[model samples]
Target: MTQQHGETAEVRRDDGELIGMLRQVTDGGWVPCAVFGLPLATPRSAEAARGFLLDHGLGYLADRWEAREGGEWVTVQIVEARPGEVTVSYADYGHPKLFNERRTLQEPSPDDLRRA
Candidate 1:
């Protein structure tokens, strides 16, 4: 994982090495926020930054996925994550066909879909 912001140097590491680095970040830097009904990270933590890489699957924060039905790139924010299911919301806010659901958007993980 690597993060680049405003002239700051790049810090890159593999996932296996990520956990130890997360521990090095100071407590003061960790900002509390919501994630799938849990509080696990903050902006200051790189592991928190990669929190988008769901244990159950792949992708990054606010990852964009191409809709199978309409071919639109819908941005998604993971609201819930499980083995075969992932609940998400419109990271892009809304779209006519996608937002048709009245409740939280519950969908299957990309792995569950067959190759096109």
Candidate 2:
């Protein structure tokens, strides 16, 4: 499959359609983001997004794996990370409920990295 790009982009779930944005945070790790709903949030409704990244603020960004996803992408959030695995969620903020589903990936070796 063609690799999808966009750090500060939307998270599309199912339907092969756009769901909402997935703003990636670059700091202590590679996957910390604030998910927001479609058309982007108007400062007010963006609480969820901002709140998620609130704690990670400066420190996390400094040590994270440098990366960027630039536009409205898919609805998936990396909630937890381990030495060789990661826990994720369907980040369709459009759903009323921000986190709709959760999943885990064993490992993302170099081969798993998406082509830029």
Candidate 3:
């Protein structure tokens, strides 16, 4: 996201959907592509950037997700998944009904892993 300066690499999902492009900045740091509203990590090497994306890529959208609402963690449904912007709705373990909320994808709440 930083001004797009440096070498670039294309990262894709298993299904060949573009996750995002890694941008190497002037500081010799590699920035991984963003997915599902997740934060962009600036890694020191392109290898690290690619590894991070391959491990936690767009596939995350298919997994169950939870969100904090009013200080309580509740299961939510991902209504939409896109780079930098994601929409979620409060789920009742059935169909999601309620306000569609736009979240920064800044928080990840999985069973054993936490991501930013």
Candidate 4:
């Protein structure tokens, strides 16, 4: 896929949390990208991009996630989430002491994982 590039503007929460960013696409329209730079939607006007990200927020991360590990996908619990970093712990399925921590630069969105 061709990479999209443009001037960037950061959107932040009231508490100064970096929420997302608005990136200008080739057509001079803005695209709303998630905290870790995942494009969330089609190109829109600058104002629209900001509104989209604010409305989307971080609520989606509350759901369970599967992280790609060792050529396989494993269930993981999000220990912490920040703008560009996410800390996850492997889910312990009956094993009480096998907690492993992994840091991922990008946390996949629900659609990205396609959970059934």
For all candidates in order, the CA lDDT equals 0.36, 0.37, 0.57, 0.66
Distance from true location, Cα of 35 in model 4, Å? 2.1
Model 3 off-target regions past 4 Å? 1-10, 13-16, 20-34, 39-44, 55-57, 92-116
What lDDT tens digits, residue by residue, belong to model 1 across residues 1-116? 54434322122336522221122234434322222222234445444434432341232324443333345455555554442244555444567556533224333423322112
User: What's the CA RMSD of model 1 in angstroms?
Assistant: 13.1
Residue-level lDDT of model 4, residues 44-73, one tens digit each, is 998888888888787545656676555556
Candidate 2 minimal-lDDT segment of 10 residues? 60-69
Tell me the spans in candidate 1 whose CA falls farther than 4 Å from its real position.
1-69, 93-116
Q: Give the clashing pairs for model 3.
A: none
Top candidate (TM-score): 4
Error of 4 at 76 (Å): 2.8
Could you give candidate 3's per-residue lDDT for residues 1-116 as a string of tens digits?
Answer: 21233366667766777665576778887777555434356565877887777777666556666676555566666667664456666654432443354454533423312232
> 1 or 3, which is superior by TM-score?
3
Clashing pairs in 4: none
Ranking by lDDT: 4, 3, 2, 1
